[model samples]
Target: MQACELNVIKYILFVFNLIFAISGIGLIVAGACVLSEVGEFSHFIEGRLLAPPVVLIIVGCIVFLVASLGCYGAIRESYTMLMAYAVCLLIILIAELSIGIAAAVYKGDFDSAMKNIMKDSLHSYNESRTDRLAWDNIQSKLKCCGVTGPKDWPSKTRPLSCCHPIREGAAPPQEFHCQDAIEGDQILYNDGCFDELKMKAESSANVLMGVGIGIAFVEVVGILLACWLASAIKNKE
Candidate 1:
């Protein structure tokens, strides 16, 4: 390649690295937000259900580190660093492809597993105040009642959190007496917590997949640029 072409490749690699670094920061912030929002539920749910965000944060940090190496290699015209950057990008590409495939193949199983976990958490809701509060928050925020709907409560009564509009302009109803009318006349939320949670999980999975594919494409371009630059440096030597 000509000197100008080599310079162009180097600058492209540098820009890609900068984008990757920014993506890394995004992942970290996203993961932290997930953790913060989940609060106590993070501990209540199984690890697999919550692993993706954490994995994103870790992988993002790794990408940032690798991108830094790429930028430095390009700027310094260091053949060794360029080779190392190419190898790192290849590894990241393989890892991301594997994860994407695995996620697709096991998507159904993951959904089922998450449902079971939610059910277990519901069953144990009364065992701890923390668990109970978590369930209340989930029910209120998701506009859901029990794992399978209001029927799961088994006592023909629902928690106050399940009451839509929360009986405004009056004293709040008792904890489990929100539905004071005939069961048919109550204004309890009709959806199930499990279904609501499942929908959320699926949405999050899609976002993660999209982000992974995007980053993988960038990594491919970066690898190509690193390899071309490394070759040019060798020829000049």
Candidate 2:
């Protein structure tokens, strides 16, 4: 090729490198935001901060690395480097497309399962809290039943409200009244509630894993495309 032609090719490569760099930086920034739970730049549609999974972090780093190679490859006019980056990118792209399809099929199932788990956890928390409150009420009510109208109580049987000659001596009597009914409730089932919470946590974990995997795939494909295109310039020359 003529000197002028080579210069033109270099210029073209430079332009491509600039474009790829910009795109790579954008993807890396987005991934970082998601991983760190930073700004709303990469949040779920629900307007909530969503942390990206470890897979996404890996993918983002790979994209930035390949993109950096693209810049260096253009500067050095190194076909081998470009090709290496292209191959790496292509592998990731293929994986992303394949795994993304699989994930798409099973993602809904995972989401549904997670939702059920969360619902169960919430129910458990509510039920447990209620039962605990009831248990306390029952204990208080028993104390009330133990106390008589200060007339029929035995000497040893003391009322919860008033104990004459307190340890502190001459302290005012404290009144204790139970609000629970005498007999109209079943025992609290806190175990089931706790179990549900565990399930909910597990489900959330699965969702995050899936999201990270998916994002990793995207970054792979994007980087591969840029690298492959950059290498093609050499073949054309």
By lDDT, who's the top model here?
1
Cα lDDT tens digits, model 1, 81-121, are 99998998898789778877887788788767767776777
Runs of candidate 1 exceeding 4 Å displacement: 35-40, 165-167, 170-186
Q: Which lDDT values do the candidates have, in the order given? A: 0.76, 0.45
C-alpha RMSD of each candidate structure in angstroms: 2.6, 14.8
| Clash tally, candidates in order | 0, 0
Candidate 2 runs further than 4 Å off: 1-3, 34-54, 126-237
Candidate 2, residue 165: CA error in Å? 47
Report how far residue 145 has shifted in candidate 2, in Å: 38
Which lDDT tens digits does candidate 2 get at residues 1-237? 554555565566566556555554655555554444322111111112232233444655666676677667756767777677667767656655565466557655644554454334333433576433432332232222221122222343322322222346655434331112122212111122223322433454455555545545554554554455454556566
- Screening candidate 2 with a backbone cut-off below 3 angstroms (N, C-alpha, C), the clashing residue pairs are none
